[model samples]
Target: MLKQNLSPDLTPLRHAHRLATLYSYEILDTQRESVFDDITRMASTICRTPIASITLIDAERQWFKSEIGLGKSQTPISASICAHVVLENDVLVIADTSADRRFGGNPLYTGDPDLKFYAGAPITTADGVTLGTMCVLDTVSRSLTQEQIDMLRMLARQVMMHLELRRMLRLSEKTSDYRARMLASAAHDLRQPLFVASLSVQSLLQEAAPHQLKRLTLANGGLETIKKGFNRMLIAASGHASFTLAELDDTDLGDVLEFIHANFLPLAERKDIRLSVLRTRLHVHSDAVQLETLIGNLVANAVKYTEAGGRVVVGCRRHADHVALHIIDTGIGMASESVNTLFEAFRQGDAQSEGLGLGLWIAKRTAEALGVSVQIHSVPGRGTHFILSLPLKASTEPSSEPIVQVR
Candidate 1:
């Protein structure tokens, strides 16, 4: 028998955690972003549904981040199909809403849309707490193929990645000791998402077909990027004044490049930029998490500045006992004088560019901590190339104190 309550179990313990996790992202009631709208549009087309929405079920209402055809921005949770899915914590599908006894008396059916179909995949955080769903609805009775269902779920994961990225960036804005503590807390929270995402990719790979399998692989790559970034965030927060290496190990340059590709592919594609990575097996002896953080920041900044039709290529080569990681972008570059200030705190190169301009500064700090050198070459209105050089092996004389040196 179906549960009488349409909403989730309101047990104080679990419910509060779920709501707390949802609110922590600071996404509720925010203006719609094209990134999210793009996800919903893809769902509508892929699922062949007339109406699709990224539904966040808050305490009293379901706020739609990107409501494609619903016309309204939100509705009461009492009339929400997504709230029911929240309780199940999995993909929920109803071929014919009217035929389902669980939603028989729901007022949504009597509304203008007269919804008849729904397939919702949980938008679960790393903590395993479900905040909402990437759901598609149809006015006529219909069903989705297995592939469609998987794609829907995959899209939901992408939504979580964006939310996570935004959360980290928003919180990173505060540079106080208190902010570092908060960043540390946020970084620790990501542990749950990273582990869950890894396990999920493994399970999906075993059953996914060739095409779907490829996407799942890329999704795993995306997971690796987030995992490393947040782990580095923890490192940064823990030693706010001086970056610390959690572990010094053989870091694969190829894997880092692949991760960079997977994580930013969507953003680059959206900007009509060609993002490429050189296939390499070369390794560098450093903190794997720090490599991800610094390199991730460089690639992120490259993609942001590059114009449409421009290209960003990341590659590396061995030089003596060192490896020079190269990230070249055909973006609007800055003057050499402007480049000098790129690593300064709270610096902005382009007034029009969003962000506190702390990306490269963070990269510089991480590189210095790793005892590496960064070379930036750029021409205003031309392009930029950032080269990060580090020893192929760890230093023989390792100091416990933080290393501070000129770039």
Candidate 2:
């Protein structure tokens, strides 16, 4: 390592990109961490100094993340002697401040800088952006051996690793929160459909009609989708990983559509809407529960937006290499401008909209996780259409009995 001199460039090392990179760790002004305190204590022990600190430099100040024998938690950048370490590519050492004409009366945290000694290794990022330093100082004039200097550099590296690991955990927690919110919103949307199923069950118990019993069957299937999807989401959140559907073995698209139709049938009927599915016995490789969820959300949105007398249909057609499943709704379609931002979370055509505005966004995310492509076409005052292109991988068909509610 280069032993740097006191001749600092004097230019503030406040480069915007470098500051942004340091701030990415989200460690500034946070509560004191025991791990960092331990490192500083070890540094003091190894170098036999009265003071040691782990610091971070922002634009205006150098804040001590961890320190021992330092009375102050922070000081302005101009007052910080460690601030010069950011300008050095390697460790900087001043054997005796009293010998240096400019530092004869400088104020250090120990309140005795007349003849103090300082040694600091630049706390550098993997790409070599120096944030601050891991440093030790003494009121008496002294210097560290080459071995002690190398050890100080090693401690600097350990600081960087802890910062990196902490950043990753925080980012993972944010992603898990996002996915959990999506799942909770999705779970909220299913309640109305599920409640309608309960009503249908009551009618069947009173012997109102045989079709009433079919609605109950649809509710049962939808419950399975919720159970399986919830478990998958919990697993993803716990691991701080993205929601994945690697278990796409073989799924019956017909069965998937059948569940969608059953789940939303009663909701559509209450609004005097005709909800129907055009059946196809197509087999595709996908996660069945998540596939059903994607289709279910689209179908749910279709029923929600369509007028009382309008119609929403679900169907599929074969292409050369994939199957195009369609969700067509004759309702109050959105403008082209609104269609562009439909998949962004919480974005809606009307600010006073009815639902939470997560349906289309959830649909979009689910499609991505399942490796399905979604296309939307809509025009104001007419209708909206959704197309999902599923990968072509047909296998021996799964047993899918017809639902009575499908026309």
Q: CA lDDT, every prediction?
A: 0.75, 0.72
Best by TM-score: 1
Q: List the residue pairs that clash in candidate 1.
A: 126-193
Put down candidate 1 lDDT per residue, 237-312, tens digits, no spaces: 5344632356667777678778888999999999999888777777778877778778988898899988999988
By lDDT, the best candidate is 1
Q: Please identify model 1 stretches exceeding 4 Å from their true place.
A: 1-14, 175-407
lDDT of 1: 0.75
All-Cα superposition RMSD per candidate: 11.5, 19.9
| Residue 255's lDDT in candidate 1 | 83
What does the lDDT read for residue 367 in candidate 1?
Answer: 80
Candidate 2 Cα deviation (angstroms), residue 72: 43
